[model samples]
Target: MKHPSVRGCSAIVLAAVLTFGSGAVAQAASAPATTPATTANPLDFYITPASLPANNGDLVRTEPSVFYVDPLKTIRAQASVQRIMYRSVNSSGVPVAVTGTVMVPYAAWTGSGPRPLVSYAPGTQGQGDQCAPSRAMATGEEYEGIFIAGLLARGYSVAVTDYEGLGTAGSHTYMARESQAHAVLDATRAAQRLGNPQIVPGGPVALAGYSQGGGASAAAVELAPQYAPELNLKGAYAGAVPADLPAVGRNLDGGLYTGFLLYAVTGMGAAGGLDLSPHLNAAGRAKLAATDNECTLQSIASSGFLNTAQLTVSGQKLSSLLELPELKTVIAAQKIGNGRAPQVPVLLSHSVLDDVIPYDQGRQLAKRWCGAGSSVYFDVTAGATHIGGYAAAIPQAFIFLERRFSNRSAVSNCWLYG
Candidate 1:
């Protein structure tokens, strides 16, 4: 099952990726292509009426749908789009229902080989079912739909997951890493299993996400080596990764992210067994329920900069909620840097001045993963805020994906390889 090792990318600091290995040859052949895999039919891959899988990563079912992706910049009509429900495991390894969408652009593969696919994970929208990417993308109203349009313009197929429960009939697991990673990776598996010729059944694939999505992408890359090894993941681009849940929690507990804390605590509680009713006072309980249908604006505006200590019965910080044994175990599994090293290359970007997820945690992620022998392309953006860092990282992020999809090996700045 081993493929030949391609040449590695140049370890440049803040420069666009240089031509490497057979990339130049591949590019010289056509618009852009890579090592192709075998062709397939829809049923040849997916199991219909997909019975409950005993395994962790599985594709449940898919139904065709329209994607109203009219971004600020318009592109050709979508060739195909589907609303898919798949099977994935939570942080505790229990099977859960996950939802997402797969879209193919009007652009066709003009290259010598098949087209590349990018499995994109959107950052926090909200805990509400209305905030799901598939729901928003349907109306061309999703904030990130414009960005997705850009990917379609690049002539690559795209698959986006709404994570488990966000768009479905349950509470979102929020920051639970395993659930997030399973949803993202399974979206790719579901797309390929659909046997879309535009997807290049065996072509190179990449992962991209920012913030919560970034953390999910990091988890996907680490888990990809085992959970879904059927994929040929070439690279992952993660922006503002929340590598340390403990650190992130301590920072957000008494700040503008009070609603997010509620979401995470309640989310993990729902997934695991941490009940907040014992810890939260009556007002806190009411606020949490009132925000059930609230989107980002509503959640942030209502709970911003508030301290959880005032809402709790003991009047202490929300961090105390993590004192429970099962909760601590789930949160530890959600931490990103402690997992298996990514077999593929990874691009990690973070703003040095991020207010939400600390910049130091991102640095720690790179250092620890590099120490574990991961090829990391670390970019520390200057002056930008948490969201701004995503914009700053996009240009080079594409370069990273292009080089990887073109069949090049990735070089690392992680030289402390002892």
Candidate 2:
């Protein structure tokens, strides 16, 4: 459906975002790593049941939990929290258990109708089981906890997915878009089934995320219609979405964020059951093995700026490896935008100078969505790096959700691109 195009975010918002751009970028580099205190034990909650649930999103288990806004675990959100394991399918269409957290604020819902739910897809937390957001949030170490708190403060219950394998028995399907989408949508389903009076089963829902989370949210939005048609999905906020893996991989080659590229390659390989060992030399194999239990901070600290050529037997960069016939098909299947256009309104934001996740690819996604006649509000910003772009989009993203939940009309800016 073609929604009317309206004016983009005003100049004041852009100026305010720019003011914090540099600081946000600096903060992104040193984002807190999950402390050892949280990972000492193998939590049984993440273990898949011997018998799987028959339906997707059916709750496997639930336990009372906590949420913290700081590393000290002092500042907690004024909400009820639960760590949950639910049924979700993986990329190969096999049923797998996914873990996540569902939080509902204690404050009364002052918004119109039932309180809205934000099915939040979290940005990368690393591939390790201990790096799961549910664990990090309990220890007050989750980097995205602040954003989840923001949603709670707005009286919007939040469901944050750990994605496949993050807290489970297998390797995390890092950039495998379909699996991420399944985890996200099922997280929402699991949240509603928790029987919270504040969050009605068919209540308003919005997908929100940045970076990996952005890609997951984007994928979930595209897949929601067929995967979970009963959801009352309102709109989605996907910022700095890695819509094209090849584009993103090429940009990250030999750069400061090469860790992300490595994560993608290793993750896709694990998810697709491809044996990358043959192509990798000793250094490459060791590097890939290193990520088996490491989180984002560890990966970046250890692997940043290291060229993939040094790790490959053929001395080809990681970007080149993605072009292999077997790998190319896997990566191509992960690409979003060429498939279904979202049925609801979408606020697709990107920074022109995003140091991570190239900008042009994001614009191309917007253009493609527009061509497919989706309701798209393409919000363009300037001078923000990857993290900065995320910081800048938070307020605007929340506002976009507010408008949608309030039943306010969202005008698309798709015409501007044409």
Candidate 3:
């Protein structure tokens, strides 16, 4: 699978414009509340059994309940539970409606005045709905629902966005900022409208995610000053964010992590209206098209997913599709931080041993925001892998959110040596 050629100067020019123009558009759109608009009815986008492939062996449209400790648990063992829904959407104004779960704690109605909301954007899991529910307990797996359940226990409402596509109709735009940001922010809005009284109105709110979620959280932070100003975005915590797309593409190509690269190229193509088939020959097109609907993990499971033997006219490897000069030009132009740092305080953490997303990107992002005069607290966890780093960083993340909601500067050295 050779890389596509930028043979025609016209194509090169057009790519340049789309890449840079969207960036400018994103930046220019980052201020003053635009009148909030209603997205299409979410029920109209449900993922029915008939919609899935017969051979697809993943769970779909299933509801699960989770048990948690409420604030009164110490007095008497009271079990708190939440019912969650996993469904799809249409008219997100993109190819997919985005699939995710909405959780309403049973204790929400128990005399607790509306609780503050926390919308979580999870890191790269897979495109399948089975793996990306908003609440960890919904999966019937013993992972970390503690953070989520603890928030609920403390009387805070939470909603999680699985990102656009994934369990729906389009490709998952793995780390694309705008799409990810829109899903997280919009889902919060949708959850609020879902009429769970526990979801506080005009309450202090926060955003948190690791890796891909970190990238989305960063974009949500940047987008909130204008996109959803009504929601009190007190703070954000991003861990091991793949802030620089080109840099990540370079490190992931042709390695075991290459599936992410394919997802990026295919996803961006779908989102940006680039026709990759024209660049690929018959065989290349087949490979690219085959992955259009696959999730991140599924794509990796399939073999020979890319034509790594050839090169684009720019002499880049076929696997470098995501790192094409034209793509890089577009990404750089977007200026994800939008030439300004997030208005709210930010906490960013990364591990030096993270092989998936290089730690340098995290450092650069912190430097960029801090240099732009944003209050950013950066932490580099020692001897932590990507997953371990997230756990190690969570306690501090809670502290950061707590301080922001309390209207005080976060204690700077809380996670300094962890």
Identify the leading candidate in terms of lDDT.
Answer: 2
User: How do the residues 1-418 of candidate 3 rate in per-residue lDDT, one tens digit apiece?
Assistant: 1111111112332232333233322222222322223226423333534443221111233333333222221111112233323332321343234545555544433432345677788766543433344322333231334445444444456777767665454556666677788778766765655554656557667888877888889888988887778887888888888887878877777666666666667666656656665555565566556555444445556633343544244345555565556565545633455585788888888988887788888887877787676777887886345556666676677777667766787543323322
Runs of candidate 2 with Cα error greater than 4 angstroms are 1-42
lDDT of model 1, residue 82: 75
Global lDDT of each model? 0.72, 0.82, 0.58
Best by TM-score: 2
Clashes of 2: 0
Candidate order by lDDT, decreasing, is 2, 1, 3
TM-score, candidate number 2: 0.90
For 26-105, candidate 1 gives per-residue lDDT tens digits of 22222222221322642222222335655543556666655543332132234467767777777777677677888776
Q: Which tens-of-lDDT digit does each residue in 1-418 have in candidate 2?
A: 0111111122342344435333322222232333322334438677777988889999998888777655655566777788899999999999999999998877789987999999999888777787888878877677766667667767788999999988887888898988999999999999999988887999999999989999999999999999999999999999899998998999998988888888888788977889888899998888887766677777677788997899988888977889989999999998889767899999999999899888887799999899998999888887457766777677678789989999999889999764
Which 10 residues in a row give candidate 3 its minimum summed lDDT? 1-10
- TM-score for every candidate vs. truth? 0.83, 0.90, 0.70
